[model samples]
Target: MRLWHQDLLTFLPRAQILGQHRECCALRGLGWGKKHSTIDYVFTYSVKRLVDYHQLVLREMENRGYKPDQQWYCPEYRGKNTVPWTCTLRDELDDIPDGHIYPEHDDAYREECLANLRKKGIELFP
Candidate 1:
């Protein structure tokens, strides 16, 4: 539902990139709204949603008159680091004890991400 700008230098250096959707994150409602949004999307939705959210964000930017680089990334906005669901105190209350861990514990985070992508019928790569 929100748009985001990417750091073009990190991914691409030629075009402006904006995103229609970004990661689902928890909202603390602090002065940093961008950081809040980034955290909210990651927790609100699955990892795929979070990843695709980044894409949605770009789409939004384009819709708003922002052109993207060949890789479809923005040059003005940067995604700041934030806490993730797995890393939060809530921990893994739904999955196996070990699975509750982040991508490292049992690869659950990554597994769930892939599963979600498949469930969404999304082809991540060209």
Candidate 2:
């Protein structure tokens, strides 16, 4: 699965935004460290980067009046069917990392995401 560029989070359609939230949850949980070509770049950095990126998706969802479970704030809160939370505890991040959350989320990646959306008949203008 792919994370639509963060810049597009605000403009993503409802389905996409929700899908992104699920994607983030998967990445944080069962999908962590799994090699998938579309999102391999995400594994290069700390899991904190994914958490930081997820905050954007959560914010946009909240802005649209959707209330996602706050439990997601924990870096290890995997959704359904997994070990008990206490066994997988991870230190909560105190602050977002400095600079771009993912250095790979550059202008080129933004345009690439936009182009992918266009292919899906979802046109978004920057």
Candidate 3:
């Protein structure tokens, strides 16, 4: 849904206006944190950032009854995810914090994605 949906990219004008990677990263962090008061205007800036990847982009769009974008990862920037960080998406389902929930699927998901990437000769940008 996201890969093909041009609206997601255009929905958050701020993303396109973001001059630096840091700025985009900052906005992404904001959206993920659910400090998302600003998303009333459109879809969501965090969702727009999905354009940077094929997987989430497609996943999001598919979730919305849209066709998945046939996007491919760029080879040049494939192995250099110098972002060196991930957004802290605290679940806003409830304000009460769930203390230290262990992620049991981390290893499995990581291994699965890595294997798929290797099979396609796509090196992950770690």
Best by lDDT: 2
Per-candidate local distance difference test: 0.34, 0.82, 0.32
What are the clashing pairs of model 2?
A: none
Which regions of candidate 3 fall more than 4 Å away from where they truly are?
1-105
lDDT of 2 by residue, 19-101 (tens): 99999988888888899999999888777778788988999999999999988866566677654245333555434334567
Q: What's model 3's TM-score? A: 0.21
Candidate 2: stretches off by over 4 Å: 83-98
Candidate 3 positional error at 63, Å: 22
Model 3 worst lDDT window (10 residues): 1-10
lDDT of 1 by residue, 31-68 (tens): 22444432343354333333333555456556666664
Kindly list the per-residue Cα lDDT of model 3 for residues 17-58, writing each as its tens digit.
Answer: 222223333333433333443223223333323324334333
* Candidate 1 whole-model C-alpha lDDT, 0 to 1: 0.34
Better of 2 and 3 by TM-score: 2
**Candidate 2 Cα RMSD (Å):** 2.9
What TM-score fits each model? Answer: 0.25, 0.84, 0.21
Residue-pair clashes per candidate: 24, 0, 4
Of models 1 and 2, which has the larger TM-score? 2
Candidate 1 wrong stretches, greater than 4 Å: 1-45, 70-126
